[model samples]
Target: MKRDLELLKVILSKVEQQPQGAPFITNKDFSTRDPSLVAAHIQLLCDKHYVIAAQNGDDKWSISRITFDGYDYLDLLRESTLT
Candidate 1:
């Protein structure tokens, strides 16, 4: 599947909002979107070193935290959307 930058941003934002070292955020939390789609985007985020995630299955993910790069990218995304 193609990468979804918007979804990537949303995932980062959600992960950031969670408390430090909190339990992993799963696709279930993103109920509005298809779980596989969310999981795919999450895999991209993990591959990009944006978020730390563990693969639960072929189309499942458990995201734990956002990396420094993740925060930086999220900040840029937020800024770009404002103008």
Candidate 2:
């Protein structure tokens, strides 16, 4: 599936706002969005090293946090898209 840049930004922002080392739970946080899409986007971000995603202890839900690279990427997007 193609990357959803908008959703990616939302996820990144959420992670950034969260306390350090705290995971942003995907399901709980992205309640209004399509779960599969969110998961796919989070996976894509993780694959690109823009975010860290972790799922443990048999929990079906995964959590993520923005990485330094994610901030850089978000900044680049902001700069490039600004009028």
Candidate 3:
């Protein structure tokens, strides 16, 4: 699990598009990814207030949703990517 900012952006975008406060459906809506890794990334995002994640569990396929801060972060990342 390396730091994958691009994938992080992707996750953020996916989650942000969902209804407010509703976690995105990782299994059905997004591309295939390692559940554990996605969870870890979500945790990192949570720490930054970029997303809201559930409690860590043995079930790796947990869901997360983006926040207002997340949209802001995404805009920042997008700018960085462009420049």
Off by over 4 Å in 3: 21-31, 59-64
- Per-residue alpha-carbon lDDT of model 2 for 8-82, expressed as tens digits? 777777777888667456645788888777777777777888877774433234656677899998777656653
lDDT of 1 by residue, 2-78 (tens): 77778878899899999876888998799999999998889888888999889988888999889999999898888
Candidate scoring better on TM-score of 1 and 2: 1
Model 3 Cα lDDT, one tens digit per residue, 1-83: 68888878878877767786574555334458776677677777878988766654553434566678888999997888542
By descending lDDT, how would the candidates be arranged? 1, 2, 3
TM per candidate = 0.89, 0.76, 0.72
Global Cα lDDT for candidate 2: 0.72
Off by over 4 Å in 1: 81-83
Evaluation by lDDT, superior candidate among 1 and 3? 1
